[model samples]
Target: MTHNPDFKDGAAYIGGEFVPIGEAKISVLDWGFTRSDAVYDVVHVKDGRFFRLDDHLARFERSMARRRIELAEDRQALKDILVRCVQLAGLTDSYVAMVASRGRPRVKGSRKPSDCANHLVAYAIPWIDVIPLEVQERGAKLLISDHPRVADEAVDPTVKNYQWSDLTSGLFDANDEGFDTAVLCDGRGMVTEGPGFNVFAVIGGGLVTPERGCLHGITRQSVIDICGKEGIVCRAGDLPRADLETAEEVFLCTTAGGIMPIAQVGERVIEAGAPGPVTRRVMASYTAMHEDAAYVTFVDTPTRFAAAE
Candidate 1:
């Protein structure tokens, strides 16, 4: 069970073989690469255990089903590959991703999606935060970008896909304005989500997040669960820009960063530019839940990896 020095940086499972992360590759002609025809899900490990592993796996499976991308590995096999990647990298805390991609078509010059082969690739790397630690400490500055999120009718937000034209454009605008990140809105100016996270607002002593045009993030659900346990009013519904701009407090939730407080939205600063008490409480509760047996699956490095190999 010794870790390979070459895999210290990271490890990957590809083409029925384990390899260093840098060696992982997909053909340029792949539909997943050329046309962004792929679905992926990320699950994080903290303190040598995966948080909500089953929930993430379920979501990953659902995404693949929705995209009609079938792979050789089933749910249990996918779990084994992810665990093996983490073990090979010798990482206690890591960011793991499971991806199902539409490969190149079987017949030459074929255009039908069904003709293309589908495959899965997975990797585990050092832990990462969507919002940097320092920014989270000071609370992030977010820009309400003019770029609107892709219409739900055209692209299903429920399935995790690689369609990020709107998100990337918004992020570019945010960076140019000297902000940390940006959140896109719907056609009617209702807030949707940020780059890789879900948005939340505390208004009039209640918590609200966008009910449409955003990913049903696992962390977002966790926050809602914490609110229920703590007797906090939280709901998912239409959130107008004006309401969000003048809210008492705002924060973001993602698999990469659990509860990230926001100091400013566009031009207005919130609570004198500091994380509010509600946010602090929720953050503490979220961190504590990592230790709860019901929510965690400890990494069985030796047992799982041996069986997987």
Candidate 2:
């Protein structure tokens, strides 16, 4: 096992032990690895503070409950592990994730869910932005995916899971078409979401996003809150492909990057294929919130600084 020289690069808590991320391991028999039976959430830390920490934790708990997987650690205990993981990494800005997975089945060939134990895995690594800063500034180009989202009846979209086959295919389609990313639609041609982000559009001078068939992102909620504060007139409802194609502006929201503007959908140009006024406004507002004391959940920095004092 090798520990990376820079602590801020990689650190993880596997099973009941803390280890270098490169050293962390899961058994081949684990359901999470074999069948992709896992639920996880990522929370962003900026300047030693977690943004919307409680909201992320609450959504994670809901995802776990929906999957019928429970870890031995309670909310407070899990939060402590996350904080310690960040401390171990010595990262002022990081991307941290909490995962709960179905473990190896105990009865050898048993197919029952109860035959396995569930476990928690947490990690802290340097911050990541899904849409790079340069890309965001220039704005992203999205391919309206030919592949559709998996029916919500089969797998609830609200529960964060590892069922990404459909999304993966769509992303490949986007790449083949020479686009930045993809946005999926439902069977009826209603826009559902993108691979890792929620879709939003500025239609007829109003902001709208799909009401169903997408993960209820914490950052999406933050955008809505910002809209309410700024009086931007945002709403959630069915957004058709036609509306998206003809919209004045579009953007994606996720924890990795708060708000990313979209300049084109396939061959359609929006706001002259540039980040629009409303999109820029929301992005600015979301960015400013990270530095606001009200939105930050600070990590245990005092303990780390104690030895220095």
Candidate 3:
């Protein structure tokens, strides 16, 4: 059934129907809201084209599966919803997210996961940058959090869920220290990642990032791929706090911000405290690839609201 133009304009999909974002809401009893029993993924759109849509969708599928959340929508259906969400917002650059949640239990008092149904929710809003443009331009200052990241056994970082207590606490610690962001280390004192961003360091003419205790970010994978094509050596393994502090350069990767260079890690300046040469090369290549047809998915060809506009 076709929805009204207003319903599809700057709207959101909730419970399989289109409504304004302000009206989109889930049940208060939903485990997704109560227990963070949900997984989500975001893909950015530029010039009405989605970047790495397929990769993001694949990851979202994996996250949902890991959480044992089953939904009726398939990949194609989800893709259509994403495109529609972006089109509805009439945004050229947007932040698009898809979420799968364990719905409220069928029996109000049931404690079994089996009694709950899974549901999907998604939205597209104006573009978001994990590191704001000004911060990116000036380079970011990072504080090493005394707080450790949540253990992999407790909650898998590989599955992107709403379990952000540790991350948020790190941010608070960073804020108190007058820093732009925070990166948490594991209990073993190995550098993990920052809130909503993956960490990387350039040392001995190669790139090294933590192999564990970090989300396998889509943007991180893009940087690694670009490295292979550009003949820049990049590896993933255990990165200690000392290694990060003494690195020649540091940067962050995220779906929201793309590539962000670091100026300092707790007052230890990186490469004269500016975006380094390798970081610049990667950022330039990443920007140029946005125009590559291979990575862009268009959603405006037959936009439902084009006639009204």
Best by TM-score: 1
Alpha-carbon RMSD to native, per candidate: 1.9, 2.6, 2.5
Superposed by TM-score, candidate 2 places the C-alpha of residue 254 at a distance from the truth, in angstroms, of: 0.7
CA lDDT for candidate 1? 0.92
Name every residue pair that clashes in candidate 3: none
What is the clash count for each candidate, in the order shown?
0, 0, 0
lDDT of 1 by residue, 1-309 (tens): 224448988999888778899889999999999999999999999999999999999999999999898999988888888888888888999999998999999999999999999999999999999999999999999999999999999999989989999999999999999999999999989999988999989998879999899999999999999999999999999999999999999999999988999999988989745579888889999999999999998777454556645
- Report the C-alpha displacement of residue 117, candidate 2, in angstroms: 1.0
Q: Rate the local accuracy (lDDT) of all candidates.
A: 0.92, 0.87, 0.88
| lDDT agreement of model 2 with the native | 0.87
Candidate 1 lDDT score at position 1: 25
Model 3 regions lying over 4 Å from their true place:
1-10, 301-309
Tell me the lDDT of model 2 at 128. 92
TM-score of each: 0.97, 0.94, 0.95
lDDT of 3: 0.88
